[model samples]
Target: MLAAKRMFSLAVADTDLFLEMPSSTQALYFHLGLRADDDGFVSSPKKIAKICGCGEDDLKILASKHFILPFESGVVVITHWLLNNNRIKSDRYKQTLYIAEKSMLEVENGVYMFTGSRMYPERNQNGDITEPQIRLDKSREEKNRVNNNGRKTSRFTPPTVEEVQEYCSERGNAVDAQSFVDFYISKDWYIGKNKMKDWKAAVRTWEKNQRQKNKKSKDDEGLEGWLNA
Candidate 1:
């Protein structure tokens, strides 16, 4: 999709041509009988005459004299030839901007930039802008969110004896040296805060259980501890 476009080139400047044209002819060019785009062009001569307060005959007379480019066919070749010449100088003759699809396959000044799919704006060869870039970027972000389902959100999942055994076997009994750092930071332990915090938490539970043991409420000491006792 083309969001915007701008054609830039210096207007034809030659005092000889200027002198050849009458003031009315020059005024017609100033008002302009046509508007150009990257792929096409347009002009409403009727509206133009009405807006400029120019008589319909005056517009025809001026258009004939100045060779004002119209939306009609063959203008592209005419424009190309004129731009190649050194005599004309409008700033719009040399370059144009076309905001199009991000997915638009483009060759600009002989370089490719945008690639992949388009939506919203209709395709037109005459545009310099593309909207496909936005579409693909949004699509990727949506895909990532969808792919992350079933992923855990818990800060820790208690380490298992099996995991500890696997790690020791992988190390062949030689300490990895960074094992402690990994255990502390990685999901391998799900460990957080300090060892002191774990100890404090354990002590609180142990003391509560001891009170239950003293109370002796029918095996409340815990099955393993009571069975041992």
Candidate 2:
């Protein structure tokens, strides 16, 4: 699932890489920010390129500049993801695919300078440096597990824009998949009043609505010409 929000640090403007990079690279970075998980990892570059119109060259450029680190597993970890974003509460934070990729990253000479450090610093009872405690409030956990309607919270993963695009294309519909994604994303993946239980259902709904609207427009145009003739 995508993050509800992500920080774009102003510090990037001061970096040489940001200034020197081409517009295509800059656009790719921005799209990655939108699609990345809470851990700042983007899973599939090919899919991202298809959706965002940025090419693989952009990924190579970012990785070469140390702005991103690419893994053999096809994962790209944004170097400054932790630096730019505010820390999330441990319970709400989803585990990243990076756990398994970190070892491969290290072997590949990828930079992970913050490992075992205080990304989420916490003080001990004695006010001394200590390991960060993962404080999971039982009540909050239970609340998330069950919705207001008493249904179990959905395990539904939000589809990326590229995935939506493919689905729409398969049905020969001209639905604006990105716009659909943006709308739901803005609402924190909720429908009109509830959390979206199924995103594919939403996609199908959009496809049906768009197709019906198109057919009505064509029929209206034909009727108008026939009446005039």
Candidate 3:
């Protein structure tokens, strides 16, 4: 049986990471947490959002901000669910029915992270529907380094355009592979003043910056429209 009462952590709800989101999105998150099962999985977020006077954009914001992990079956799991409620009684705690989705996730620092490759739909900049692509889990890659002599070495390997393309494709983001390779090649693969340790992380950062830029552009367009009106 599911627990009747739920808990929230001030560490999560008080931080800028949670506070920076729009009020509606924050409200949606709380509602989701309240309605979630003991395993922190919500099988019907859309219905909950609708009932709470929230919209699809609120859910999208939560997903984009990494506050929730969405599955293809329309289920979502709170990313910091374990962090919020870590001491539930074993008898009342029930496992999530989304075992497949749960298997894809691993906990790190009390947060759920996707560690498996799964295909998900994402729209391009042109607002066109594209083929679903696998999500990349960079943490699953080998971290140990070795040289030709099989000795451990701390060397950075610059990724090729094809490699970047594969990663970007898997991430289902609009990060141009050729441009990324070209920019990093010009910089000698150094991020600012330091040599890059992980190219996959850099690619993810670029994707994040691109998303912020796009959101800012949209906000500017809205401002301009309002001013003209």
What would the per-residue lDDT of candidate 2 be over residues 46-157, giving only the tens digit for each residue?
A: 5887788888777766654446656546777776676565346787788776788654332112124222221222344544322222222335433445678898774554
Winner by lDDT: 3
Residue 124 error for model 1, in Å?
A: 40
CA lDDT of each prediction against the hidden true structure: 0.35, 0.64, 0.76
- Candidate 2 regions exceeding 4 Å error are 103-229
**What number of backbone clashes does candidate 2 have, counting pairs of residues 3 or more apart or in separate chains?**
0
Off by over 4 Å in 1: 1-11, 69-229
Model 3: lDDT equals 0.76
Backbone clashes for every candidate come to 32, 0, 0
* lDDT of candidate 1 over 164-190, digit per residue (tens): 344546644433323332333232122
Indicate the worst ten consecutive residues by lDDT in candidate 2: 107-116
